[model samples]
Target: MLEDFERGRVSAFFRRVADSIPVSDRPASLVITHLLAERPKFLEGVARLSDVAAVLPKPRSIDEGALRQVKAAMQVDELNRDRFADPEQATAYVESRAAGRSLGLLDVGGYFAPALEHLHTHFSGRILGVVEDTENGHQRYEELDKLHVPVFSVARSPLKDPEDYLVGQSVVFSTEALVRSRDDILNGRPACVIGYGKIGRSVAAMLHAKHVGVTVYDTDHVRRVQAMSQGFRTAATLSEALAGAGFVVCATGNFALREDDFARVANGAYIASVTSSDDELELSALNSMYARTPTEPHVVRYSRTGHYFYILADGNAVNFIHGASVGPFILLVQAEILAALALLASGQYGPGMWEVPAEVRQSIAATWLTYFHGVS
Candidate 1:
């Protein structure tokens, strides 16, 4: 059953990417992603697209056979290279590739920030644009007014159809692992979710659905009121949110949680982050304060007040760390990626951060309604 779902998802993604390309003009596109190592289906779909020139994988644990298959599918001698070992190597390779012509960059998690800067510094006019996938990346892109290139972000898309759906589904899966660890973990316990954005709202809703008391913190007064309107308690400050919560979830896409916040946490509470940005938590400070390394993969057990505090996924996105995130529903997000790449390839968007167009958003939503749910 699982294999069948994966196959269909990959096929649909490939078809969308292929359909979006123009026959006469297929520009060179460089894709840098950590998802390739974990989600090979994504790599397979994009690699076969007409515009793909190179792939830079930040490997966690790469499947050698899958990597070979992706490389073979590229069907080009242009910019073929081994996986990047670090940011410096990636920067050098991207600069080398951008030497002659303008290139398109498709990235997740802001991993290619340095390389993009390198292009801006030396090869000022060599970039067509960039397509970013994560909310954290969108926040970073917003800071660069003189970026010299366009950046269209799926995370910042005004159309909330995909983000709302994915965030809700992904958080449910992420919280499952925590529940399994202790059957009655959430019963009558408080879970504090920072941020009242789409992702944070979903996380809080899921927690509330599980009968866990939820407290939300967002700097925006309107967002705070919004949380209150949803029947979830609101916290005026980060410190207030950390008071006695048994579970803490950071989904703000900002570095809102700090070492000081952790100091106020309940002795045996659990902490997790769902945002792609590593900065959401003060992880380095957390490690140094403990004076110990994580005893298990993606989990750290720190002793506090004769009990222990638990940190999930090393403060990375919990859904991804636990298991296949959002299961096959990730295809909806991949469809948006295909649309963004298509827009870039067609030279339709101008400079600065752009929103994913309404047409693309509706098309993807229609695809999901038709194929995934048989809703027509």
Candidate 2:
């Protein structure tokens, strides 16, 4: 099934051949440009169409729900290099580029862009203009000369204002979506959280902050040690952690849990995944034994990222999937995404595989809501 998926999905050719392409005059657009709002790597089966042809990759933020569908459909793997291996160093690199410059702000839609613009405009410091649109072209701007926009790293956090905004509507949206999925684990009073990687660790921290038990679990002993040092349980194996756990959140990048793994899990052991790859956890195995759509129903989804089931958006990056509310932070995310797009196309970030920017994911969600869902 996995190989067929790889062949049927990932291996499909994307570029239109000369024989396949309809003849046209005036330099026909052989380039099939795709504006992706969610993580592009998840949609695995179209490169053949663009192979040997120009592929202009544009990023847009999309609905978290849609993001998951895209990932499952793509059958992606984590072969791409992580851009932020040393997050601090990556962030510092961005800062270095803008030593004494102001980050130029561009508001593409009525979401994060506006909030960020509002901050730059009304806040104490000098801020560049807030555009109603960026469709019209501009060679460059003055604000990017300043270092306001942190557009270089994996911006997964929320916007911070002078007064508490609850992360505001956006933060509320994220928390509620996450809570709904793992509510059972909370009810069970989990013994520990089995998180996969940095993202899983982040969620574990969030759960820990709420006094919920969190345990770092992955094939990586280093991650386990890191979690233990943080003063949490460290289990060498899945059984050790699941022995008394109320729930589990799998963030590991692999989805190879066979039927036996599920059997070992305690009955009604709640679980969720927040990784970029949706295939990491054996959702199919869990579905065979436990809840179904009839038994469980999806409540309102928060901005497409936060919904039930330890919410995961398009199996891309969890933070991006869960983040759909108005976060001024997304503004920087958009910029970094634009930077990434630039890198991919211009060969600055030579590519085999890569993820679309979180901001683009949100934007694409909104766009699809309009194009496919008939909403504006």
Model 2, 242-277: lDDT tens digits are 665655565544552444565555544444443323
Task: Give a tens-digit lDDT track for model 1, residues 1-376.
Answer: 2466757656775576457554344556777665333356675556444356567654442345656767667532222222232545665666566555557787776655545555655552356778788777777777754666778788766544445656655765666665556543566668888888888888888777777789999999999999999998998888888888887888877786776766777776777777543558876776545744465566667764455677777667777654434544566666677677767667766777786677777777776677667776
Local error of candidate 1 at residue 179 (angstroms): 5.3
The 10-residue segment with the lowest total lDDT in model 2: 25-34
For each candidate, give its TM-score against the true structure.
0.83, 0.42
lDDT for 362 (candidate 2): 51
In candidate 1, which residue pairs get closer than 3 Å at backbone N, Cα or C atoms, i.e. clash? none
Give the per-residue Cα lDDT of candidate 2 at 128: 27
TM-score of 2: 0.42
